[model samples]
Target: MSATPPPYHQTAVRPDWRDLPDGLREAVGGRLGASVVAARTATAGFTGGFAAVLTTATGARVFVKAADLARQRHLADWYARELAVLARLPADLPVPRPHWALDAAGWYAVGLDAVDGRTPRLPWDPAELDAVLAGYAGVAAALADPPAGLTALGLPRLADLARSDILWWEEVAAGREPVPPLIPPARDRLPELVALESRLPGYAAAAPGLAHGDLRVDNVLLDPAGRAWFCDWNWLCHGPAWFDLAGLLITGYADGAGLDAVFAAHPAAVDAPPDALDVTLAALAGYYLTAAGPPATADPASGAGTVGPGAGPAGGNPAGTSALLGAHRRFSGEQALRWLAARQGWH
Candidate 1:
């Protein structure tokens, strides 16, 4: 079984509550109507943004994430976009509710209902994975036909996003990006990979719907009752309903789960193309491989190889500047490629 890369679980070096600017702190406290009595910094995911659960003297708690508007403008923009997306999301959706937002003291911050839960344990806890899959079923059903209010945000089409920002096979085939050592067969299979990835846009447009866009284990919270709450709304987009399911199952594939069976059983797969999973895997593998970064021939302005929270096209990683993120990307990409290879009997 492919193990989750340790780096994926420890990418953040989050700032403590006290490390925040005094002005920003004061503003947050004012908005919450109480000074923070205790703060527990969250240390998950690949961003250096300030995220924590803050408790007031009255025991009121809120999960807050903040970014310095000047130094981390990309993160700030992402935060702003997330808040907007959350505000527009369906009320019954299993996402945290935004409590408030602040744009003061050169920082942008938002408070959300603190989830009394933790990130799902890796290595595929069967029960937890089941809960997550069930949760996603609801998400897919709800978003299959998004309301005008939600779609009004003008999310990018999955096909357009994949073509312009996500896919990377063409770059690799052209020798613009390095071939990852683990996927040596990719050198010979470049033509097939490119063809599979090239089909994503047309496939996506044929069955378009709103999608979670960035559904990873790190972005899910398993509550005490074992319900999954999806987070990170900045990547929301107009896409095939099955897209997020394919992305979310990558870890399952890594854990040696029967991902083919799982994918076929998912409600999101109802109308998906017979080869949709293959196409998506190829595209995502390409995304992660290049997202690991520093490909000399990649367009400097495209920022395709970089990591972190800069939105590209509509929104995505502007640069893969973090070593931790690079490691996670490499691990994810390799796993995806390996899984696809196995499915295609590519050895």
Candidate 2:
């Protein structure tokens, strides 16, 4: 395994929710009742802006997502689509009940039955980890057969997306501005990165299934009873199961041994193709390279401050980019590179 990279900053751009339009407040009050109190922003990072807790007069707490209207229409669209998908899911699925949603005004708000639980911290117990993974597997199984009349979520297929990501990295290596190093090795091994792109299609065709495109621990909530409620459906799409598994493992959940245990516990995921892992690493790399940057106060609509000014705030801070890239290297660097090398066919 390659040595892990150094720590980097994780600066996230947060939008002030007090800046939301008055119509949005009226819409929430009308739908959720007049006594809705808006809480501070709960999430900070990436597009779609941030989330605030809306407490109703009846004490019902809902989450309101205010997105960058211009740059992240996809997030607003995803929220609506996810609502539809959640509505079709089995009533028994361990997910938050979608009470209501408003898609207009560049805001996506959904009322969820609040689960009184904290985000599980790292170095989790084996039992707890098993429960979380099992919960994910259960959700995937329940939604195994998507409902009819449902259009495929417009997310790019994972393998194809991975190939595209590697090419982007190569472009960065070729001195493309604003495409700095998330993981420096990616720049050092441009040929291998290119190879990864070529070999992706074969793997993509071989294993196809429903996947939670982003399945990190942060997106899941584990209740006191040990059940995990997966949230953040912004990236759900059709892909291999291993893509999800690899995401879980690579994002600092399980190591090689831990991943083995997860697979052993859930035999249904046994046949998850290796390419799924490759895509997972590639996706992580691509996201860091593309989205991670200095805190951009730029409205996503204007696309200004999208990358921020300077080589990032101060000092040699890599911020979100380094943390993300370091995670990939620490958890799955060899696997990531092997996938890249296989694609490049440059031994």
* Residue 118 lDDT in candidate 2: 48
lDDT of 1 by residue, 143-173 (tens): 8888787788777788888878888788778
TM per candidate comes to 0.91, 0.69
C-alpha lDDT values of all predictions:
0.79, 0.53
The collision pairs in model 2 are 9-319, 195-343, 195-344, 196-343, 196-344
Overlapping backbone residue pairs in candidate 1 total: 4
Q: Give the deviation of candidate 1 from the true structure as CA RMSD.
A: 4.6
- Most accurate candidate by TM-score: 1
Judged by whole-model lDDT over C-alpha atoms, candidate 1 comes out at 0.79
Any runs in candidate 1 off by more than 4 Å, and if so which? 1-3, 7-9, 252-254, 294-306, 309-322
Tens digits of lDDT, candidate 2, 1-347: 33332121122345555667677777777887666665655542333355666676777777666554566555556667667666655678777667787655656666655655545555456776777778878777754565443334444566665554423544544655345333444556655444444554566556545567677655667788888887766566656666676566544443334454455457446675544445445644544444334433444333333322112111232222222322332333444444444444534
lDDT of 2 at 67: 53
